[model samples]
Target: MFPLFLWTALLGSAALEGPESRLLCTSPDLSISYSFCGGISHMLSLGVKSCLTKDNTKDDLYLFFVPKRDIIELSVAIQVWFKAVQVAKFTEPLCRGFDDEYSFCGVLKGETINITVPFSYRKFIFPQGQYTVLFEGISGRSNDLIFCVNATVILK
Candidate 1:
């Protein structure tokens, strides 16, 4: 039989799957509007949870945006920091494997861009704790900042 605390944690994890956990972007610039809908899932259990699991976690990031200008190119950076120390970082072209309709590699003014990136966490092992996840989008041409979403995630 599971302990009371373990049962409670399991119940709490179930509650997280129902819409309690969501990505909230803070202090977004006025030039663009952004939003995301997705969650992290344990690779072994395949359960969608609010927190991230150690090596072998998967992140389904469904992000959308409305650009005010013609965006020639874009890049994304996802970093995990624990206690102000950089633990892991992933950076790559924003629309590498996505289809053209969901790619933001080249966008036009007033066009809406929707992208879904499935991130595989197979490199680093995060200890059980809370960490900050920073998701950033930037202009690939001029290296200008586009937007950033800073949110917290637990690693269990």
Candidate 2:
């Protein structure tokens, strides 16, 4: 009977809280489609998938430029057991045509857990007039993760 009570209490507490999530959208000088996923328990990382389309017969040169400075918005959902979740925000410059974007570190019950990670670049340079950009997120805890995702880039 004691074990049943503990299980019920745990399950009840878990049901009280839901997962965390965030939404992001923007327009850029290139066209792209991609997906992002992330997790955090003790570390941080990101993954991206991208594709580009160009008119081969055109003489126009494509230039993709990454932002040197910018701001981002991070959203996260929390569950009951991990109620004390906190998220941190920061920025880093990209290499040439790509910038290193990150999500603010999230903390729950004094433990730094991974949260949503979303990034943006002001101007990116692509070698061709048409290209695709994919931004991705990775995490130390795969099963418990948040994905702050956007999936479209405008053409210049």
Candidate 3:
């Protein structure tokens, strides 16, 4: 009887098909803007319920926070070398590491609102072969929304 109950609970949780997570948020009334120059673009904002920052003496990051069933999406516009890219990183308080490439904005709600994060990565440098943007999502287990944004400029 206990085994059957456990199986049922597991199945029920699996069936909860929530909204497909997106890397960017584009409401018909909302649009993010940037100033572009020298193969680089600037991010205006990232919408979500998380904290995000970048380590750059010459560059800056624009962050957005949104709520989710379990965690939050930390979206940011990354400027490197002379190019820009948008990426979403998910974080749970219980989790130790960040999951990169969790999702990219591929759908749009309207012509003016894009569901996917925009990226022009031709000018960024990742000296370590890859650069990652990190953030902390809302988690009940931990109140410390310790978010981090880092990129290893690998010029390949």
Looking at model 2, which ten-residue stretch has the lowest summed lDDT?
A: 79-88
Question: Candidates' lDDT values, in order?
Answer: 0.52, 0.30, 0.30
Model 2: lDDT equals: 0.30
Candidate 3 lDDT for residue 30: 28
Which residue runs does candidate 3 get wrong by more than 4 Å? 1-56, 69-128, 132-153
Q: What tens-digit string does per-residue lDDT give for candidate 3 at 16-111? A: 312222243222322222221221112113443222212321222334423222333333333332122334334332332355344322211121
Candidate 2 lDDT at 140 equals 32
Q: What is the lDDT for 142 in model 2?
A: 36
Clashes of each: 0, 21, 19
lDDT of 2 by residue, 57-154 (tens): 11222212121112232223321111122122233222212242432323232333334323334243333233222222323333222332323334
Let me know the TM-score candidate 1 reaches against the reference structure. 0.53
The candidate with the higher lDDT, 1 or 3, is 1
Give me the runs in candidate 1 sitting further than 4 Å from their true place: 1-59, 95-102, 122-124
Q: Candidate 1 clash total?
A: 0
RMSD for each of the candidates: 14.2, 16.9, 17.0
Candidate 1 lDDT, 1-156, residue by residue in tens = 556765675355345444434443222210111223223221001113233334335656555566654566667788766665668789877543335344565677667666665766567555756676666666766776566554565543
